[model samples]
Target chain A: MSETNSPSPMRILYIEDNPLIAFHVEQMIEDLGHVFAGSLDSFAELQKQFASLEMDGALVDIDLADGATGPQAAAWLQERGIPAIFVTGQRQVAAEHGDVSLGTITKPVSSSELAAKLELFR
Target chain B: MNTIEDKSLPALDQVLILAPYRKDADYLGRLLAEHEINVRAGARIDDLARMLHPSPGVLVATHEALTPDALATVAAHLETQPSWAEMPIVVLLDRASRPDQVRAELGRVWPRARLLFYQRPVTAVELVSGVQSALLVRLRQRDVRDHIAQEVELRRELNHRVKNILASVTSIFEMTRRGATSIDAFADDFRGRLGALDKVHSAVFHSEGDTVSIAEIAELTFDPYRLSGMDRIVANGPPVTLSREAGTTLALCLHELTTNAIKYGALSHPDGRVQFAWNLSQDETPELAISWKESGGPDVEEPSRAGYGTRYVRSALAGMFGQKPVIAFEADGLRCEARGVFSRVAGNQ
Candidate 1:
């Protein structure tokens, strides 16, 4: 791994039930010169760990281990002044709660798209 | 008269009377009311238009009420009705009226209506029975409508599940490819994971409430190892059902553990043994604890490099239980255990 090209380094937390997808995205965030915070599966887990979680941005999936509570988790983060982006296959679901998110990056995410969207964290 | 239901659109139990002759309309309406049947009587063409919107169970119209405007309104309403609905209409004709010609004309005008004709001097018993019969048929049509709606909802639910499964497979494929050292290794890993997923799906589908018991998952997960002319794995647990998500995560984790054991742990040797068990602690929170222990195999030492199986077991269990699992590579064999609140993954609540 080489350095000296990143503009800003941000720790990104991902909320997804599928660990495989989470792992892939974890590597993607690292590849983009950003730090991977951690992965939580449900909104319930998010609430429990919210106060202690250190992250500049959050990536969430519309459906989680608990159910379809991704939009609610994003709103929870938004209320605390922390920004979030929805990385999900359920684009319509993400759009319905678009006000709580910076934007959406559809699933089977490419590095270029994620890197660009993470830039909107500020 | 009192109304049974205030539905603006009439239900299958209400009758509508369209008679131009006020006397005839009053007579029919009074007769139906005496039978305790709901009746809506209208004389003007405007009233007929308004009444048509509230699809009545049976329409009682006098021969004189079949004016061009009245016929057009009924015909238009019938045209827009759902395929399952055929509006019932009862027409009172003069005794001298040519029955055959009237029947043919009415059939052509209201193509989808169930038309029943009665002579002018018809008896009360006969008219009442006829209307009762028509209402019965309408009730059955309503049942059909409800059944169709339920089926549509079931189809939507099935479609949603199919999409979620596809997304899961895509994730598995990409992740398995990431750690593959060779093409053969990739195929074997993908096939094994997919089989575990498919078997868990079957277990969940067969179980009531879309939940699979921990015992069933163990039986299915450990069946292959037991079938190979030896019973090296012993699984024991009380009846504890988990939601589809939790059951799937558990099943896949078991697969990774079992395969690792066969490849490098207890099951790798001829005299090897594996013990799998789970318990719910008696407490306010009722934390569920599951453990896998092995012995009588080659000396176990932590591998310097962790592959997809080890990494997935850690990440998936942590996500599912809201707690990370402990994996120990002891001298005898490998041991793994995780404990979390029972309520978090309980099914059908």
Candidate 2:
């Protein structure tokens, strides 16, 4: 709530497969004053990165390459005490999260909204 | 200048105008005149319901005097509206009002609507911002719903087109085959080939537009003979998936083998039986083994002419195996053993 108590810059692992969105989100992460660990498309690659990389938070797309969605990835991160945000194309899916407090930004995500969401990771 | 629109707007169409007093509706009406939005003074409870159509776009219900009956009526109408409506109903409660009274006033309707509560007397900036937020959410929901509907319809259309194309191709092949040979002979050959292709297509379709399941391909290969009661076929393999190309090739090969069996092998007589089994081989060659053994037909002999079906079977097996299938027509019955490479093409976990 206070500026002096704000956490350090978050290290974000953004998992998205769409070429256009991935490109824009990667740029937006840097513009928002955070470190982009990397962007991954495959579940196998994501798992490997999670095991090896030290990330403070994650932004995942619900629908991913090879039928793996963001919810499963988010659950994994949450279990490890790392917060995650979902960037989804569909708002209906967004509404279905009745109680799940993890933030969601329905696509197409703007730079300001992305910054506002990622700020919570701190 | 003082009149409301005579006709109703289309269903799912919404208009929002905030009036500090009743006279402001007229000014707001002229401001939004070109947009053709419906504007009215003091909506009754029943008027709200009557105005609602199958599709809901937006509604702006602002409190006039917050009378007991009027407040209850708006509250009741809000409870009846659909959740997706994203209606912006502004309540003009005094900013310095008692908490208990405000709570009681809003409690009746707040539970239903995704509302933006604005304390009145309200300003233009606050009113416009509240209305804009609600309208933006409503428009977004509409776009997603429409896009999903279009996507589902397109998929169905593509599926229907695929079926039509396959059917026309079958007819063309039949017509060409008929012109080349005697009618009955051509019909029989064409039907057999078509049956093989249809089996593959059926397997593909049941797979939800992906590659055919190995389980499905096996059932298609043996289903007809199983019904006849002369031949009993058993299938066994790991959970394997096959591409459209591979499934069709296997279906055609199985048809050739089954036809030969029915004509001269175990299926030719009631006393005989044929067993068909396939499994991924252990050599790590990524290959599948389909072994067909015949038990009872009259003494078998290799035919003089390698017919069109035989050529197709040989070529298909050759392409799959890098060698011809082992075909032995012995004195007892005919035994065919084919090995084909396996590739998991779709619906893989």
TM-scores for the candidates? 0.86, 0.42
**Residue B30, model 1, lDDT:** 93
What is each predicted model's overall lDDT from 0 to 1?
0.86, 0.61
Instruction: List the candidate 1 regions with Cα displacement exceeding 4 Å.
Output: A1-9, A17-20, A23-49, A63-73, A90-99, B1-11, B19-44
Candidate 2 residue lDDT tens string, B9-98: 233446644444666565544544434444444444434445443334555544554556545655566666544444455554566766
Among all candidates shown, the one with the greatest DockQ: 1
**Chain A alone, model 2, TM-score?**
0.83
RMSD of 2: 21.9
Q: Which sections of candidate 2 miss by over 4 Å? A: A1-122, B1-181, B282-285, B319-324, B344-349
What's model 1's TM-score?
0.86
RMSD of 1: 4.5
Residue B287's lDDT within candidate 1 is 91
TM-score, model 2 to reference = 0.42
